[model samples]
Target: MTDKRDFAHIETWVFDLDNTLYPHHVNLWQQVDARIGDFVATYLKVTPDEAFKIQKDYYRRYGTTMRGMMTEHGVRADDYLKYVHAIDHSPLEPNPAMGAAIERLPGRKLILTNGSCEHASNVLARLGIADHFEAVFDIIAAELEPKPSPQTYRRFLDLHNVDPTKAAMFEDLARNLVVPHDLGMTTVLVVPDGVKDVVREDWELEGRDAGHVDHVTDDLTGFLQGLLAKG
Candidate 1:
């Protein structure tokens, strides 16, 4: 199976978890957000109202709430992850179809996420797709550098021994996809509804259209199926 289309050039496929792999409307993010709020309130001795506001502020400033907490609030990363993910994992359910799709995809697959490896592992296990990826690059894996930063993409390429030109990045966030596109990797955006707004970032190479991402789709299984069919 060989075709000259853009996505066919990718020898390595990097996936952003969370909203990318699964449907975002599932409301899982709200649970995680609430956990962060609870953690902040308990550990920082702040009211729940103040804690949620500060946590959102941290996310806006540092990309990840843990980053701000570690830098300014002096919170430890492991401690924060432990506290935040202590919430109910029942919201996550196995997706055998996604797992099968992952197993069938050609080339190497890796997960690059801003979340902790513990969280990535738990989520993957819950999704039943943990065995498909060769490696999991989480928040700690990139030295705390998160998405939308070219540094994280560079670090991911280096750490995974991947060539940027031969890789494809699948992300739900358009802003995070910018650096990958700038680095010469083909970008795929997964918008489950086909109605979500794209996120704009500050570091994207100006004049290059973010809409020119190689492909956009509603789900990982459909995306992978389309990619395989193109081969």
Candidate 2:
């Protein structure tokens, strides 16, 4: 995490979507995962326990289970995306507060996510903030490389013409933000109270209590407002 005082120094802002876009209390991810689990159970013919483990392992090995299935098992990316994000969007209503926060942010805003473009777009549209970001770089943009991969971060910088010193990253996943921190970009970990409940153990290795992160907060609206005020 970079110093809050350095907020004025950044000229670009990058954000991770999903839980970071709205409060984790929304329980949006759980719904998405249920779809993934269902797909695994049916396709792999595995028990729920085995499906979960296999999903985790695939994510660990290929940065994303979709990528793992694509490379190892020849699963089609479009087919995988269609299957996983086919959930009902009715539960994910529009978030005016989140949209307002996005409007308040400084510099260019970009959505960086491990999910595919289709998934990202559907979520953003459901949240009613599809127009907030200047660009949406999804898993497909990264060539299927997911978060926590230094190469994906590098590609992000190159593709977007983002200067590390002039940018800050807001991510719910601490490990995913580590590379950005190492590369001299400000890192903000958005751990909204019980938001850490669903985070995996290995991903939560450093835990949210570590003071090394530039900033930790439960409220993204407050954080964005504070940055604007500081500037």
* Candidate that scores best on TM-score: 2
Relative to the true structure, candidate 2 reaches a TM of 0.88
Residue 206: error of model 1 in Å?
17
lDDT of each: 0.78, 0.79
Give lDDT tens digits, candidate 1, residues 1-231: 222128657688899988777776665666778888898888799999999788878887788788888888789888888777776666778989878877887789999999888888888888889999999998888888777677888898898899988888888767787688778888887764645543322332132235537667777787787767777
Error of 1 at 175 (Å): 1.3
RMSD of 1: 4.8
- Residue 56 error for model 1, in Å? 1.5
lDDT of 2 by residue, 1-231 (tens): 534425777878898987788777676777777887777777788999998888878877777778777777778887887888877766678877778877777678998999877878888898899888899998888887788889999999999999988889988877787788888888888875664555334564454655436888788888787766776
The 10-residue segment with the lowest total lDDT in model 1: 199-208
Residue 102 lDDT (model 1): 75
TM-score of each: 0.86, 0.88
